[model samples]
Target: MTHKQKPVIGITSGDLNGIGLELIVKTFADARLLDICTPVIFANNKAVNFYRKTISESNFSFFHTREFEKINPKQVTIFNCWEEEVNITPGTLNETGGRYAVTSLEMAINALKEKKIDGLVTAPIHKTNVQSEQFSYTGHTPYLKASFNAKDVVMMMCAENMRVALVTEHVPISEVAKQITAEAILSKLAIIHSSLQQDFGISKPRIAVLGLNPHAGDEGLVGNEEQTIIAPAVKQARNRNILAFGPYSADAFFARGQYEKFDAVLAMYHDQGLIPFKSLAQGEGVNYTAGLEIVRTSPDHGVAFDIAGKGRADGGSFLQAVYTCADIIGQRAEYGEQRANPLRKVSPEVVSRLEDEKIEE
Candidate 1:
C-alpha cells in the first residue's frame, strides 16, 4: 500500500515543557518521513510554533484544525487544545507543562476510540509533571486500559529485529514474588501470541519465557517461582499449541542470544527486560502498547527533565515510533489484500487459536 492509503496516525505531543514538542516539531519537519504515514499531532499551535522558532526550525508548517474529520495528511495537522500560553523554555519543568502534556494524550486517545485515526504515536510525557486528577494511572499502559475498557495490556519495546515484552510491569521489586502467578504468565503469553499474529503478522511466532529467579532459581535451590509459577505457565501455553517455552535464566538468555531464537522474550519484571532492551536499543527503540483496540507506540525513553527544553534532545526515538506505526499499518493493509484473494485461506490452527481465545474470554 502507498503511504497515502496507510492509516492516519494521531501523534500526541506529550509535554509542552519537555522534548515532546521539540522532537515532534523536528521530526515532522522532515517531509520524506511523510511517505510512511500521514501524521496528525494533538497539540497547541502556538506552543509548537514557539518551540520551533526557539529551535530555529523553519521548514515545517503547523496547520491548525478544530475538527478531526478535516485532517489533511499532506500538511502538518494540529488538533487545537489551545490552553493558555506558556513560555517555551528549554530544560524547565512545570505543572502547566504536565497538564498540557497529558491533555494531548487524552485527546489523541479519544480520537483513536472514535476511529479518527488508525494508530497512536505518543511523544514522551513527564510522568511527574504532566499528570493531573483526571489522568490517573502510573503511566500510558494503564491509562490506555482504563480509557479503552481493555482487560490487560503488555509493554513491548522494539528496536530493529529485537522485541521484548514485560510480564510484571510497574510493580515494586519486593512484590514481584506475590505477583508472579501461573495464570498471569499464561495470560501474558497468550496476549503476546495474539498481538504477534494480528498486529505483527508473525506466523507461529516463537516466544522465550524468562525465569523469575536468577539462573532459573539455580535449579530450584535459590528460588522456586521458576518451577512453581513460570514452568507451569509455559507448559500450559505449550498444551494450547502455542510455541512457548522458557524460565531460562535471564542472565544466560540475553548473554547467549537465546532471545534471538524467539519473536519476543517475556521478562519476569520491568528492569529484567528493559535494561537489556534499552542497552541494545537506546534512543532508537519504540515502546509499543500491545493489545489495544487501536495501535499505540511511543519512544522508549521517558521525559528527560534534566534536558527538558534543550535543543540537544534527540528525536530518533520519536521518529522510530512514527515509522513503526507506519510499518504496522502497512502490514495490516497487506493482510487485507491477502484476505481479499479467494485463493489464500487461513490455516486451521490459526483459526482455532482465535476461537479458543474468544472462548477463554
Candidate 2:
C-alpha cells in the first residue's frame, strides 16, 4: 500500500479552547501530510464544523465506526463523543472544554487498547481540566502506565538529533533527591536500552546521565546523589553491556552539539532534561512514552492558550508527533503483525521467566 494508505493515526483533540484544534487543521492543510498518513481525530463532528466555520478550512471528512474493523486509511475520521454544540473560543480554558479534552483521551486510549488505531498522537491536555478519579496519575506517561498496569515506565523526549529519557518526573525538587533507588535506575536503563534498539533501530545505544544538583554536587561538596546513587547505577548498566556514563551538570551539558555524542540522556528530573530539549528543539519536539505496550506520542508543548485561535498555532510540533508515531508503528509492524501493543503480551513476569530459563541453561 501507499504511504497515505498505511494506517489511521488516532489524534485526541486536547482542549477546545487551546491550540489543539487549530494545529490539527493547520497540520493537515499541508497536502504532503495526507501523502503520509490520515488523521483519525477522536473528537466531535460539531467541533470540526465550528472550527471550519471560524477558520474557513473545510477539508475534514468523517469515518464513524464502533468497531476496529471499520477503520479505513482513506478518510480523515471523527469519532464524536458528545454532540452538544460546543462554543470553542480560542485561548479560553473552561470546565466544559476540559471535560471534552478528557473524553477524547479516554476514547483514544480505548482505541489503542483494542488495536483499532496504528498509534496514538494526543494533543496537549490541561492537567486541571482532565477530570476523573482514574485519571489522577501525574502526566500521560504515568496515566498510560496505570492504564496498561506497567509498574515501571520512562519518558523519552526526542527531536531530530537528540533524545533524553527521564529517571524521575512530576515530583518536587526536594522529593527527587529522595526518590532515586538502585532498582529504579537499573530498570530505567534497561528500558532505555531496549527502546533504543527496538524503536530507534540503534544496535548498541549510548546514554549520558545527568546529576541531580549543580556541579554534579562538586564531587560531593554540595550533594551526594552522584556518589550515592547515580554512579552505582551507571556502573551497573555498563556491566550489563549498556553504555551509560556521566553524572554531568545539566546547564553546561548542551554546548557545541554535545547531545549528538550520545544516543539518549537520562535526566534526574523533569526540567533538567526538558529545559535543554525545548531550547534545542524550539517547539519541534515529540513527547514519547517509551515503556508502553502500544506506542503513545504527543506534541512537546502544552496547550498554547496564549496563541489559541488567531490562526497562529504552528503545526510543526503536531506534525512531528504524528510522524514519530507512524514511524514507530511501521517499525513494530515488521516484527509482529497486529501486535502493536507490547504491554498486552509482554509483562515483567514474562521477563522474569525468560531470565530464569537462561539461568537454568
Candidate 3:
C-alpha cells in the first residue's frame, strides 16, 4: 500500500515487566508488515532496547521520532514518551512498570486525539499494578471510555468467526445479578447495533443476547431476570428496528452452536461471554472497544508475567490485534462513504434520455 493508503497504527508498550514489548518487537520483526501500516511504538529507548536484546532480535530496528511528521512508513518507529533510564526486570511487577505503562498509553491517546494515528493497538497491561493517582480504572475498556468521554462502549471479543460482547465488564460477580437491568441491557444493545453497522460493516446485524440466569430462568423456575428485564430489553431493541433476539440460555446456545447464526452475541456479564470467547478463540482473538470514536484493540490475553522475559510469549493474538484495528478503520471508512451519499433513484425521463443517447451513439 502507498503511504497515503496505509494507516498509522500507534502501539502502546504495556507493563514493562510483562510481555508487551516482546510481542511488539516480535510482530514488527517481519518486514512485510510495514507494507500494510505504519507502526509507531510508544516506548522509551531503554525499554525497547532491553526487549530487543533479551529477545535476541537484532534485525529489528526502529527510528526515533518525537513528531508524527517524521514517521517513516517503510520502517518501524519508536516515539519516545520518556527519556529516563528505567530498570527492566522481566516477570516482576512493580509500581515503576505500571507508571511507565500509563505514560506510554497517555502519550498514544493524545496522539490519537490529535489525529496523529489512525488507530491504536494496545498490548496487555497488569490491571492492578497500572492503577495510580492519574490512572485508576478497572481495565482498558473503561479507561478508554472515560478518556474519550463516550457515553457507552462495548467490550467485544472478536476472532475469525465468533464475536462476543459484554453488557457488564470488570464488575463483581456478586453484583452481576443486581446490575442486569432493562436500561443497561438496552444501552448495550444500542451500542452493539451501531458498532456492527458502522465499525463492522454489517447493514442489518442480527444480535443474540444471553440470559443472566441458568436455563434463561427456566420460565421463572430458577430466576425472573430473563422474563422481567431481558425480555423487555429485547422488545425495546426490536422496536428501534434493531435485529436483536434472545434471552437464550448461555450454555445451550453455545453448545448447540447457535451463535453461528448471529452477527454478534451480547452476554450479561464478563465471564459469561469471555469464558467462551477465550476458550473458542484459542489465542487468536482480539479485545476490541466498540462505540468509541477511534478504533482500539488489544490482545485478549492479559500480561503474562510468568513468560515475560523467557522469550516464550506467542505473538499471534497481538498481531491479530494490530490487523483488527486496521480492518476496523477501513470498515468504518467504507461504512461512512456508503452512508454519506446513498444510491439515488433514477427518473423515467433520465432513463429515456440515456436510451435515446445510446441509440444515437
lDDT of model 1 at position 227? 81
Candidate 3: the clashing residue pairs are none
Off by over 4 Å in 2: 1-5, 56-70, 335-361
lDDT of 1 by residue, 1-361 (tens): 3323857888888767777887888898998777667788898888888778767645877678889768776777888877676666656777777777787888888888787788989887766775667876778889998898888888988888689998888889999888888888888888899888867889799999998887899878999888888888999999988889888999988888888788998998999999998887866999998877778899988777687656777888889999888877776666666667533477888778877998999
RMSD of 1: 5.8
Off by over 4 Å in 1: 1-4, 336-342, 345-361
**Model 3 misplaced regions, further than 4 Å:** 1-4, 344-361
Q: Tell me the tens digit of each residue's lDDT in model 2 across 175-246.
A: 987888778888999998888877777779999988888978899998898898889989999999999988
Q: In candidate 3, what are the lDDT values of residues 41-87, reduced to their tens digit?
A: 99987788888887764478889978889998998999999987899
lDDT of each: 0.82, 0.80, 0.90
Query: By TM-score, who's the top model here?
Result: 3
When sorted by TM-score, best at the front, the candidate numbers are 3, 1, 2
TM-score: model 3 vs. ground truth: 0.94
Q: Sort by lDDT, best first: what order? A: 3, 1, 2
